[model samples]
Target: MTVIVVLAMIFALLALRLFSVLGRRTGHEQQQIPAPADDRPAGARMPAGEQQDGRTPAQRAAESAVAVPAQAGLRALIAADRSFDVAQFLSGARAAYGMILEAFWKGDRETLKSLCDADVYAAFDAAITERESAGLTLDNKLVRIDTANIVDARVDDGVAHVAVHFEADLSAVTRDSSGAVVAGSLDDAVSTIETWTFSRDLRSRDPNWQLTETDEG
Candidate 1:
């Protein structure tokens, strides 16, 4: 009976040792396992706002040459090398025209310097000059510009072809050679659509598109 009791106590100790060994082995196995890497390719999706790309945010911004333009402006007007937006272009042009005309009326040289191309500047400046010489002033300003559509808008070899319908109401007064005041009257608020063609001059760093011609109807 004492031998049986001794054998049972030995079995209990062996079982406890086995359980301790298993627990230690489990911990060691866990330690041997490697941590997962976070790096991944662009195609591989990561969690939100996480960038797996090797490039730094600044590097990515610099490397990315294309911009998805949301506003109509000079950059959107002619700086684009890819597909151009006609609506954006026309809207920008009309906005530019309004500002430029306002500048001319106010004799703001800096505004004209920024917005108008050389020839466009020359024409506008000449008009202002002639009006000044004749003691005439712009009575009513460009209040509205209604653009129908760009019938043609295509880009080729760093050049874009755009023909747009422009309709606007502009009013100004002119004096006859006689020293008599012609009572100002609205001139029928004329309705004429013009299809203007523009071409880029490669020589200038501005790469500004200029009016090539106009088809008036």
Candidate 2:
């Protein structure tokens, strides 16, 4: 019985020592997890679609254009129109895209006349007249333009022509006189890609570039 008691005491001491060496973990203990390294300044929140290299998609595209350099055609265009700026032209093209679409939908011929060349205006007018004769009206909304990039540029006989590629989302519907939907859907937003060419005479006094042609891209 004495031996048994001695053994029990030794075992108890060993158990107590083990517990002391490895303290009990309370539920309130803080977890130790390595934090991810952030190169951005403290309190900086990353912008949407921004990379760790600090370049956005648009920025990357612009950098690529610069690295590749302008083609011979674009160089000629720049030479013909000394005041032309590719960046500014693209910005204006984006605005013109939305404006032209909206004007066509509203059948605003006068507005279209101001923005488009004679051929484009005639085409737009004919479409509007046909729709009117058929007692149909178009309701269109430009949801958003995802991207607009210069796809082609050239100068021909002092005429500077630029083709801009655009990707956009639109909501459109055509209604008949009875108010029934004839085409497209108001609830459905369609994604479309188009290449629109704008031209201007470099020597002409008028500063506006007119829409010369449009094609599905």
Candidate 3:
């Protein structure tokens, strides 16, 4: 019975020591473990220069608000074909009138060549050549030009036409028969209202719109 008690005590001591060693090993393992790194949050990241889907914000905006060249052409056709812009028509007439007046004053053949019709050019060239042959020179001193009215600006059978009334103050110089300069002075400035007609001359081949006639009063 004594030997049995001594064996039972030895078993209890062994169990207590084993339990203590297990507890110490578990504490040592926990202390040796490394800490977790602080990187970022959970979900995927959005890349730079890119929106939610794929395209950049600027690219998406440009795609939405862009004006295509074809659309611009269509808009121009609608504005021009639906109704003639009276202001634009008159602006063109004013330009043609200025071209003729300034071309005459400057004796610029190129400007006259571009604006005048063939018949009109023939008339003007004949007079100019005559003056040249006669040893005479001419100068037009223009003071002012007043545009009085735009009589008609219309589109007929795909042809756009506009007529305007213009008045100008002019001073002309005419030399006498002698080779020397004579009778060279500014004349009494007069205002004449001329009804000049013009046709639409868009930038294209066959762009020249011949002046049909003129009425001076």
lDDT of 1 by residue, 1-217 (tens): 9999999678645543432221122221211111123434437554454345443343244223222231122233334532233333444455544555567875666656555556766776787788778766554456467653444544456555555556766654444446344544456354446665555533335534545445675
- TM-scores of all predicted structures: 0.45, 0.68, 0.50
Ranking according to TM-score, highest score first: 2, 3, 1
Q: Which candidate, 1 or 2, would have the higher TM-score against the true structure?
A: 2
lDDT of 3: 0.50
Predicted model with the maximum TM-score: 2
Q: Which runs in model 3 stand beyond 4 Å of their true positions?
A: 1-84, 176-184, 201-212
Residue-pair clashes per prediction, in order, are 0, 0, 0
Candidate 1 matches the true fold with a TM-score of 0.45
Output the TM-score of candidate 2: 0.68
Report the lDDT of model 2 for residue 59: 51
**Which pairs of residues clash in candidate 2, taking residues 3 or more apart in a chain or in different chains?**
none
Model 2 — which ten-residue stretch has the worst lDDT? Answer: 28-37
Residue 120 of model 3, lDDT score: 68
Tens digits of per-residue lDDT, candidate 3, 121-205, equal 6666777777777777665566677654555444455554545567777676676456454645575675667877655443323
Best by lDDT: 2
